[model samples]
Target: MRAYHLDAPRLDALRLVDVPQPRPGMGEVLVRLRAASLNYVDLAVATGAFPAALPLIPVADGAGEVMEIGPGVSGLTEGERVIPHFLPDWSAGPLPPLASRRMRGITMPGSLAECAVVPAAGLVPIPSHLSFAEAATLPIAATTAWRAVRTGAVRPGSTVLLLGTGGVSLFALQFAKASGARVIITSSSDAKLDRARALGADETINYAAVPDWDRQVLELTGGAGADLVVETGGAKTFARSLNAAAAEGTVFVIGFLSGGDLEASLFPIILKMLRVIGSNTGSVADLREAVRAIDATGLRPVVDRVHDFADATGAYETLSRGGHFGKIAITLEHGHRAQL
Candidate 1:
């Protein structure tokens, strides 16, 4: 099997090499991966910003066909399409006490290869309406956004403020719109903001031109501000998210895309009675709900770019530079099954 490996604990050390294909062990399934998506965390893993064992295959989001199921695996079958849970052990319940230890690419081997062996219980069927590339984007980015939006309790007439046009923000926009929420999104690029408007964004703020976008958000909402803010920019934007939120609104911190050290005051939070919560990528149940909503609404995940497996490193570079508006995917070749 062809796979990219973090031969050492350095971002520049990612390399492609051929290795023996793995087979499913007891209660495990062997998956022939068709597509995988890149995440910022994948970059952290490669660069050793996130702790990982050496010689690790590194990518958390993937969708593939069940090529083989080992003994004791009953729910899955050969040729069935599936996606592995990003945090396999945190299946359908409250967050596990040891979630960090079970996360893919950190504590476990990930889905950057043509084939991988995962416990069958961790695989969820992909929605039939979604192509492999779209399904591949859901396990991490979309699920986290889903949990964030859900935590905000979005409903009809609620306003959702998104920090950027990245994967999680766009998915949050789609979900918020589907629930009849008013969606306000920000981006540095006017063209990207235009695209976001076409995708149901009620208002788009050019953060580059309007350095204080939180004020614009407040203006757009008639001083009440947004009911929910999907805070992807972390340290750099969390303060602004708080500034843009309604008095009783919630800010769900999903990523540190703009870097992680926060320097913000808690005075506004106390005055407004706000809720500031942190979201790791959600449970398997969250993924199921996201897929169901996508399936029902015919929503499609935006793929900013797709690179062939041979150029997986280039995909990482694109993600690292923050040049993409949506998920960056890597496609593999493995006969007819590879057409994801």
Candidate 2:
């Protein structure tokens, strides 16, 4: 089988190479991956920002067909379409302490390969309405958004403030709207904000134009602020996120795209009586719930671009460039042309 391996902590180290196809072990299933999606963590691992074992497969989320089922795996059969959870060990409930360290693309074989042997328990059925490229975006981004919104207790008349138009934020926007919450999303580009408004965002802020976007959030809510703030920006925007949340609201931290170092005062959180919770993507069960929600609502993931498997590096480069509105995907099957 063919796969991309990051032999070192550099984007240039990702190279395509031939490897023997792996077989399913006990309680595992062999899947012929059709598509995979890129995430910021994949870029971190490729560039040494997030340390990982060298010379490993290099993408976290993917969808494919079950080709072979291992012994003791009875519920799933060959030919079933499924997605492998990014965190294979955390099946349900609160996250286990050690599960985050053993994740796809970082510690184990990931979706870059033509085929992978994933534990059966870690796989979730793809929603009937989505394509492989769309389902490939669900394991991490969608699940994290689902966890954040659910944790924040988003409901009708609630207000959600999303930091950007990235995968998690977009998923949160769709989910929040489905739950009848008013959403306010931010971006540096007006065009992206327009697209977000089309996605049901009640309001949009061009953060570059309005540098004091937290104040803008407060103004938008008539001084009450947003009921939930999905904080994707770490050091650069964490303090502002605290300012943007409503009193006693939740600040769901999912990413550090702007760098993770923090030097902000904790006064806002203390004064507002806010809850600051950090997310580690989500569990297989969360992925299952996310998929069910997508299925139930007929919600489709927003895929910005799709690259051929031979040009997989290009997909990573596009993600690194940072202008994409949503998830970037790569098709692993031959001649499987995907619409961007």
Candidate 3:
């Protein structure tokens, strides 16, 4: 089986090679990957920034068909489409211990392989409404958004502020809209702001024009601040997220796309009595809820670009440029079978 291997924990360690195909153990399933999508985590892992997740294939989320199931596995059949849960053991509620969560491409060999083994419970059935590439983006981005909204208690008539036009932020906008929240999106690009409005955002802010975007957000919400914030941009906008939150509001710190370091003031937190929450990846139940919400709302994953596995290096190059919107996908080769 062909897989991208990290020969050593260096930026240049990534290489394509034919390695032994993985087989499933008891209660595991071997998935024949049809598509895999890139997240910022893939970039960090490839660049050797995260030493904690060393010596593994990069990419945490993917969609594929079940080719085989291991002993004692039930309720899953051959040819069913599925995705790997980022936190397989976390069925619901709060995040599991750091010692226990096994991320697909980070801690373990991820979906970059032609075939990979995962615990059966870690595989969530993909919706028929989505293609392999579309469904591949769900586990991380969509699930994180679902968890953010659910944990932050987003409700109808609530006002929500979303940062950037990235995958998770966009999904957050979609979910907030479906729940009747007035959505406000922030972006450095005006064109992306327009696109976000088309997806039901009530208003848009160009963060570059008004670097103090929190004031703009407050103005949009009549100075009450937003009820919840889908804060995917990291340190560069953390202080702004704090400013954007309403009295007793919630901010879900989910990503650091801008940078990992943040500058924030303690005064607003104490005065407003706000809830500052952080989200990692979500549980299996959250992934299922994401599937349901997307299906119910008729929302589909937007593909900014697609690349075949044979030319994935070109895809990586294009992804590195960083102007694209939505998910970047690579379809896998066919004729691969899973062995349990």
Ranking by lDDT: 2, 1, 3
What ordering of candidates by TM-score runs from best to worst? Answer: 2, 1, 3
- Give the poorly placed runs of model 1, Cα more than 4 Å off: 334-340
Output the TM-score of candidate 1.
0.96
**What is the lDDT, from 0 to 100, of the residue 115 in candidate 2?**
97
> How do all models score by TM-score?
0.96, 0.98, 0.95
Strongest candidate by lDDT: 2
- Candidate closest to the true structure, highest TM-score: 2
User: What would you estimate as the lDDT of candidate 2?
Assistant: 0.93
Tens digit of per-residue lDDT, candidate 1, span 1-340: 8888888877679888898999889989999999999888888888777677778889999988999989998977799999998987777777888635487766777888989898887888998888888889999988988898889999999999998888899999999999999999999999999999999999999999999999999999999999999988878888889999999899898887778888999987999999999888889889888888888999999888888888888888898888578888888765333333
Candidate 3: misplaced stretches above 4 Å? 9-11, 334-340
Q: What's the lDDT of the predicted structure labeled candidate 3?
A: 0.82
Model 3 residue 270 lDDT score:
92
